[model samples]
Target: MKTTRVAIVIPEGLSGRGGIVRVTAYLTRHIQAHIPDIETHVYRSRYSDNALLKHLTAPFALAAFAVKCATGRIDVAHLNVAPRGSTLRKRLYQAVAKALGLRTVLHLHGSGYDQYYADLPAGRQAGVRAFFARADAVVALGDHWKRFMLTDLRLAPARVVEIPNGVPAALPIARAPNATPAIAFLGEVGHRKGVDVLIDALARLKAEGLAFTATIGGNGDLETARAQAARAGVMDRIVFLGWVDEAGADKVLRAADLLVLPSRAENQPVAILEAMARGLPVVATRIGGIPQQVLDGETGLLVEPDDAAQLAQALAALILSPERRAAYGQAGLRRFEAHFSVTACAERFAELYRSL
Candidate 1:
C-alpha cells in the first residue's frame, strides 16, 4: 500500500516554543517513526524568512494553506485549532480543505475554549459550527474536552476523539543535594496560571513560620507576579528564572521536591507530565485534564483552584514528610511509564490516522 502523505498546518512563528508547537512537532515526528512510508510536511502561516508577512497578510494565509492542500499531494491535512480571535484564518482553511476533498482534523488545545466559544458573536458562532461540521474528525486533548464537545457543543459523539498529550523521553538531570525542599512552578507566569495564588500560599506559609524555597520558571506577566510576590512579603524565598527551554526545565524539575500548578484553567499541561517523568510529585488545582493526570492521592495532591490555604497545606505536608514525597514521586513516575510515554501516545495516534 502506498503510504499516506500528511500535511500539518500550524499558525506562524511558534518555532517549537509554545506547547502547541511542541505537541505538533512530536505528533508529526511520531507519525513518521511508526508509519515509515508516511511522508510528513509542515505548512506554517509564515516561513522563517517572511514571518512578518504572516501578520501583514493575515487574510491571505488561509488561501496559501488551501493552495498547498489542493495540490493533490496531501492525503490528510491536520490543523491545530484554538478558540482565539486569530483563528479566523484556520476557520476559513477548514472550508477550503473540505472543498478540496482533503480529510481534515481539527486538534483543539487550551481549557478556555468553552468560554471562547460561548463568547463568540452569533455570526462567528455560526461560522465555527460550519467549520467543525465540515471536519472529518476533531481531536480533543482530554476526556473533559471531549465531553464538552459532545454535551455542550452537541458535536457528534462519533466525530470526537480523545488523545491525551504525551511527554518526550526523560532527560538525565543530576539531583541537587538537600534541595531546600523546594516547590517549583514551571510555565508562563500570569494570573491565569494562578501565580498569584502560589505567591499568596507562600506568604501564608511564611506567616506560619514554614520555611521552603520556591523556584519559578518561565515568563509572562512577570512584572505583575513579581509585584504580587513583593506585596505578599514572600519575595525573599522566591526565585524567578525567566523562561527555560525543555532541557533546562528538566534540570529544574529534577532539582525540586514538588511541582506546583495553580492555573485557573488547563488542558493536560505538558509541564505536569514532564514533572512526573522526572520523578517529581505534583501539587496542582483540580481542573480540566489535570484531575485525569494527577490522581489526588496517588501521583500527587490536588487543591481547589485559587485556594491559597489548601495549596499551602498541600505543600507543607509534602515538605514535612520526605517519605510521602518519595512515595508520590515513585507513583507518578510509574504512571508516566504506563500511560504518558511518547511512544505509546504516538502509536495510538498513528492508528487513528490509518483508520481515516
Candidate 2:
C-alpha cells in the first residue's frame, strides 16, 4: 500500500511555542499514530529570530523543498500560514508546489490577517488573492473565516473548508472546594493578549473584595505586564509562569478552576480547546473564532476585548459560583469531545488528504 506523503510547512516545527506549532505537532502525531495510509512530514519555513541567520537559511529551506518536489517525496504541501512574512514565504512554496504539480492546502491561522491584508498595497493584496485562488483547498479555522475567504477574498466557496484546531484531552485535576477559586490565563503575556486589560479587571475584582488567585502562563513583555499588575495592586494575587510546554500547560489547566484569555484577536485559540478538554471552563474575549468555541452563556463567558468592566463582571460571576464553573466546564468538555478532539481533527485532515 502506498501512503500519501504530506509535507506540513510550519515555523520552527514542534520546537516553537505558539498555537500553530501546537496544532502542527498534535495533528502530525495523531496521523502517525492512527492513520496508517497518510505520512506527514514537518518542513520548517522560519529559522531563528536572528535576522542574519534567517536570511542565510531561507534559500536552503526553499532548495530542500524543491528537491523534495523533484524527488517525488511529497504528494501534498500543507502550508500553515499566518500573516506578513508568513504570507510571502508561503507564496513562494505554493508557486513551487504548483510548478511541480503537487496538491497544496493552505491552512489559515492568522489571528489578525484581515487587518494585515487591509494594510497591504493593492498589488500585494492581489498577490495574496492569487495565492489563495491557486490553492487546491483553503482550510479556515471556522465559519467566520470561511466567510472571510469567500466574501472578502472572493474565492470560490467550494474551494474553502472550515476545520477548527484541536487538542488531546488532559486528565482532569481534583481540587477540594475552597472559598477562593483559582483562575488561569494561558498564552502570550502582552497587549495583543490583553493581559493589561486582565490586570485592570483583576483590580476591579479585588476592589469588589472577591477572593481569588490567578496564574498567567506564556511569555511576552513580562516587564510591562508585571508593572501594570503591580500598579493595579493585584500582583500579589497573580503568578506569572513564563512560556510553558505541553506538560506545563496541562498542569496549569488541570489545576485551575477556569481559563481566561482576553485576546484582542485570535483564530480559535488552542488554549480554550485545551481547557475545555480538561473539563475547565473559559473566560475569553469574543473575537475571531473564539465565539465559535466558547458559547456565550454555555461553555464559557465571553466579553468584549479590552473592556475591563465587562471582563471583570464575567470573571466575578464565575469566581463567585463554583456551580456555574462546574456546569460550564462539563458542557465545554462535551463540546470538545464531539467537535474538536485531536482524533477528530486528524481524521478530518486525513480524509482531506485522501480526497486530494
Candidate 3:
C-alpha cells in the first residue's frame, strides 16, 4: 500500500491545553499506533498564548506549508478549523492547497461557529461557504454540525462526514456514594462554559442540604467564578484547581462521581468524552453536540443551558442515588467503547483519508 501523508494543520499543535489540540493529538497517536499506511504531520498555525509573535511569524508558516505542498510532501491537508482567527488562517491554507491540487479536508471543531458565521457580513459568509464547498470533504463532530454544513453552508451531503471526538479508554472508577459525593467540572471556568450557572446550581443544592463536594479544573476566568461561588454562599463547597494538565485531568476524572459541563455553547467537548470513557456519568446542557453524547436519562442527564434550577435538579438526582450513577456510568462506558474510542475514531479518519 502506498503510504498517505496527512498534514494536520492545528492550533498550537500538541503542546496547547485546548480541546482541539487534545483531540488532534489523540487522533495522531491512534493513527500512528493502528494504521501503518498513514503518515501524520503537525503544523501549528496559531500561537494562542502569544499574539504578536503569531502575527509576525504567519508568513513563514504559510511559506512552509506551500513548500510542503509544492514538494508533494502532503497527500491530504487535514485542516482543523474553528471560528474567528482559525477561520481566517484556514482560508489561506485552503486556497494554497486547492491551487496546488492537493486533496483537502476541513475538520470543523468550532464551538460557537454558528454564531460567528451569523455575525459575519454577507460577503464573508459567502466566502466561508465557498471555502467549504471547494473542500474534498468536511468532517462534522455531530449531526448538528452536519446540518449546518448541508443547509447553512449548502454543501453536498456526500462532501460532509460526521465523526465524533474520541479519547483513550480509562478504567471505570469503582464508585460508591461517599458521605459527600465528589462532583467534577472540567473545562474552562467562565460564562461560555456556564460556570456561573454551575455555581448557582451548587448553591441551590447546598440550600437544599444535599451533601456534595465539587472541583472546577481547567484554566479560564478563575476570579469571576470565585466571585460567583462566593456570592452564592457555596464557596466552602467548591474548590478551584486553576489549570489542570493531562495528568491532573486524569486525577480529576478518576475521583469524580459525575462530570458536569454546562456550557452555553459547545460542539462536542473532549472533556465529556474523557469522562464517559472513565465510566463517569455526565450532567451537561442540552446544546450543540452534547445531546449526541449524553443520552439525557440513560447515559447521563442533560439540562437546559443557563438554567440553574434544572441543572440543580439533575445534579441532585445523581448525587443522591449511587445505583443510578453507577448504571449511567456503565452505560456511558459502553457507549464510549462502541463509538468514541480512540481506535474507532482513528479507523474512521483513515477510511476518510483513503476515500479522498
Clashing pairs in model 3? none
- Per-candidate TM equals 0.91, 0.97, 0.97
lDDT score of residue 140 within candidate 1? 82
Scored by Cα lDDT, where does model 2 land? Answer: 0.90
lDDT of 1 by residue, 200-237 (tens): 99999899997789999987888998899899998999
lDDT of 2 by residue, 278-317 (tens): 8888999988899999998999999999899999999999
Q: Which ten residues in a row have the lowest lDDT in candidate 3?
A: 171-180
Clashing pairs in 2: none
The best candidate in terms of lDDT: 3
Model 1 regions lying over 4 Å from their true place: 13-16, 46-55, 121-124, 171-179
What's the CA RMSD of model 2 in angstroms? 1.3
Candidate 2: residue 318 lDDT (0-100):
94
Per-residue C-alpha lDDT of model 3 across residues 1-356, encoded as one tens digit per residue? 98999999987778877798888888999898889999999987755457788777776787888998899889999999999888889999989999998899999998988889989999999999998888999999999999988888999999999999988988646666567799999999888999999999999999999999999998999998898888889989999999988779999988889999999999999999999988899999999999999998999999999899999999999999999999999999999999899888899999999988
Q: lDDT value for candidate 1?
A: 0.81
Candidates 1 and 3 compared by TM-score, better number: 3
